[model samples]
Target: MTSYNKVNGKWTAENDYLLNEVLKKKWGFKGFVVSDWGAAHSTAGSAQAGLDLEMPFGEYYNDSLINKALQTGEIKEELIDDKIRRLLRVRFEAGMFGPQEKQTEGIFHSNLHKQIAYEAAVNGIVLLKNESELLPIDTGKVRKIAVIGPNAAFARIGGGGSSKVTPHYSVSPMEGLKNKLGNSVEISYALGAIIKNDVRIIENSFFENYNGKKGLKAQYFGNINCEGEPSYTRTDTEVNYLWYYDAPYWDFHGADDSNYFSVRWTGKIKAPKSGKYKFQVMHNDGARLTINGNVLINLWKDRRKSEIDEAVIYLEKGQVYDIQLDYYNNGGVSEIKLGWEIPDTDLIKEATELAKKSDLAILCIGLSDHFEGEGRDREFLILENQDKLIKEVVKANSNTIVVIISGTPPILETWVDEVPAIVQAWFAGQEGGNAIADILLGNRNPSGKLPCTFYKSQNDSPGFSDYQNDDLQSKYVEGIYVGYRYLDKHKIEARFPFGHGLSYSKFVYGKPQYALNENNKAEVKFTLTNTGISAGAEVAQLYIKPLNSQVERPEKELKAYKKVYLRSGESKEVIFELNQDDFKYYDTNIHDWQIDKSQFQLLIGSSSQDIRQTTTPKSL
Candidate 1:
């Protein structure tokens, strides 16, 4: 009912193509439909195509089109009544129709949704590698534990964006373990390096000796925004307010390079334990770590790299010295990292002697403000420091199991070899901490899988920048191939592969059954059985690939997926509809979604690469 930009005379009063056949025959999505802001051009056609509610509100939606559509008999008069009733039903069902109790933050603390989120987080964690049977820390074997790293103190609950959420609580791995172990373990923390820095932090108090020209720790300073010419203000304050962004900005890209964040911060570290102690630290933009003030590993500098920096510091029994680092970023994005590997061998040896004590070294890592802060174009040609955290921790302490908390998948190649387990804790709202804790304590079986592809290297991606301008316009140059589709289509392997997940328990799949109906849509049914000792959930993925195509297409696309929970030794049938849309593709030349009646291959599997059987669809 509302009209914004008619987009020249080329855009008709209605785009009937998408409404009648596509929404009906393809998506079968006839419900109380909502008109996207300014999407309503002709009320008669849109209503006939099933337009229900014209939102949000505008002059075009008022009376003229409504009366015209009714007078012309273009839309059933009863359709309006049905739509209103359906909207009311949904509103009441959501508990948003009237007032009852004032909703508070962390209101879902004890909600089943939170439990589901926690379970999803644990399942999303991918156990890339487990060498020497080094995991399952057996916290009872180590007495003295060293928890080091930026993440040890402040956990990254989510990135910065619409997906970003202020959780009711976020449980740092440090806090989670403390809750898990209680009084039996002794833990210490070390912040080996500062987060990204700039000249802004230098003007603040703590930096009397910590300027960018540093003597105390590592330091680097530059403009906050790296894009255009920076605005200068000599009368304001320090060297540059030109750098870093003011708070409350939005980043749909990766991170913004404009704004004053932290200054290059480097800290001289001290180890509390004498035995084998562990240290973990990660930074975006620029970072360098030195033990006894020597370069252990340096992965910093801002060149659009979004990998997480990490390291395991080995200490000489109770040997305490300075750990220094230097860093700065031109705003764009932010990242926070820190974790502990494990106690030194001698410490482990000593701990074993001390009443059989052992502590878990859980390195929780993910995207940070610097890596995913505020900007519209956050895509990077290089994965940043957060990408390195898991490798660093696993290399330092075989006992380390990293838990990644973010809204989306971060590239996972460099560190997969070192980690025995991974959990995708997608910004779990306010109860982040409690949810994370619940998963690590084995209270929940991870049942989540990759929602998107995790490229092994930036080189493997098709469009990782150098595409799209600032006009809020970007093309699907890859055509219908997105996510797993592109990976399989191009035969480019990913770090963890799509639809891959692991649980404490195991599952087995039986042959799949293909059932045809008179309509083009069909159903594929398969049996899943839990064969492990513990109850768990398994996510099954269905991939559809054109046997041969009139035009080039992705090797396979994710058509349907389902997650089934089964107790130990339980089995259930998982059925999914193979609708006509499953066989559809966006033809750029035609500017429409098309489906070929040619042969299609349906591969049902545990992961994208683990197809157990293949089937074909019946054409209408």
Candidate 2:
């Protein structure tokens, strides 16, 4: 699919050189190219540039625009036919047209899929820092465990935007620990800090209906205004609804249309504490909030996207104030959330106190979809308020383990020295909780490695200044020096090197042996022995360093890697076959790939900076 980014100042959807020449002709990509939602700019230009499909109802590629473009001889009929053929070829090759097999019942959330998710979460978790081997918590000695942080209770299955999915079930870190330890260990929890600055949703415990129920009385109306008798009435647990593509009470009344609908929620809200409170109403179309018969927010207008309107008011502790929320949906995606920011509580203090009393403290903290995602690029590598949380928690409890749940690397220099152990669990799937528990309890050995170098700060990273460029056009400033290559070239030390990961068991690598075969491929062999008592897997990375090259090159480029698992005291011989293409580099002068007939050094190691053995391969 064509991305939202641009190449050489031209949008990817409209770039012919990228979509057609490089992708289709050079790479021979047989699949049809589809543009990202709203990425297609011109119907004729994009279609001619090999964009076979425009997604999400196609604003530019509509029938009228296409027909007009065709009439003007801009987009040929042959091009359209080719696009259709490519699309159909994929479907036909996938057996979609001939599919007659009956799908297995309960296959959507089958146990087999759940087990696969568990295994993936287990293997993908990277042990970044394990100072003095503080991880693999001794459950027998640690009778009391304190799980602290905002993300401890909720399972962060994935990031937001188009990549988000509704899992059948998810286990949070807190729940996972409880399930793993059972009654043998006593667990306590404290919310250290919230990840986002927005107000949290008011819990259902704070609301009470007229009938003294633990929820608000909701009345759904078919019309835009709640003027007549309601179409449906129910006790809604909360004033939060993401009624996308359907109106309120859609299931009960079968109201297919979401364009015209209104809802009224009547309830009594009790203040948890006596202080000033900020109430927020996030809505898409129109919404209003009234407390004690006084209108707080009157945003009764259409909105293209969901927006939040907040009002601050003072309320006494334990006082029941009458609250009413009126909402109407007049368009696209429908969503409404009534939230509030209560008076400041000593959340950190509470967590510290709990940590001091517990035998072990596990801080689950990291970025969520709100901080980082497809379109949401984080401004800083440091997690907001989490470094302070970790610092404070570690001071209270000497034995602390930090579990980072994120899709990207977060700077841990602030509290990394203080913490004994740290685990990088990157948006683990549905079984993430169980996987984390297994790692902590020593049921599974960690073998995952960092895919990218973790810079100490944003300034130390390559292309740091270019990322902040406001202009639409981005110059290729960094060029080939990216990630570890840039760091290696500049002799900049990283917080954690690429392919860096900790395992309970240690592996020793023997001297590498290499020879050129009759096929002109370099065959390398090495022996790996599990020195530690624990059994684990090791990812052996092979890097190729050019001895003398006409053109400038990186310090070393990763050519091949293999993950080898061995039991304690077990030794295995690992082999890697390197072809001619692996030694070739792109020659910009010739606009093609070329290989230099010079000696090359092969470095084998666990990480980019941890080379164990080196061998020189004969020149071609």
Q: In order, what lDDT does every prediction score? A: 0.56, 0.85
**Which runs in model 1 stand beyond 4 Å of their true positions?**
1-128, 131-136, 140-145, 162-164, 197-360, 380-395, 465-475, 517-521, 585-595, 616-620
Cα displacement (angstroms), candidate 2, residue 83, comes to 1.8
Worst 10 residues of 1 by lDDT: 198-207
Model 1: per-residue lDDT, tens digit, 1-620?
Answer: 32332332322235445544565457765345666565676566656655667766843445787776678787676867876776787788777867878757555666776777655555555544345544334455766655544454555565554345444445666666677768876865433223332000212221223334322442222343222322321111112111223321222222334333334334433444455544444445655556676676676556454454445555654444664444455464444333344443332223223212224456555545555654444553233444443344445555665666555666666667656655666655434555565565566656667666667776666675426558634454665666667777678877767777667677888888887756656888889999988798888888887876787777887788887999999999999887777777777797788987567778888788778777775642
- Which tens-of-lDDT digit does each residue in 512-535 have in candidate 2? 988777787889999999999899
Instruction: Report the number of the highest-TM-score candidate.
Output: 2
Candidate 2 lDDT score at position 339: 86
Question: Candidate 2 at 403: error in angstroms?
Answer: 1.3
TM for every model, in the order presented, reads 0.58, 0.87
Total backbone clashes of model 2?
0
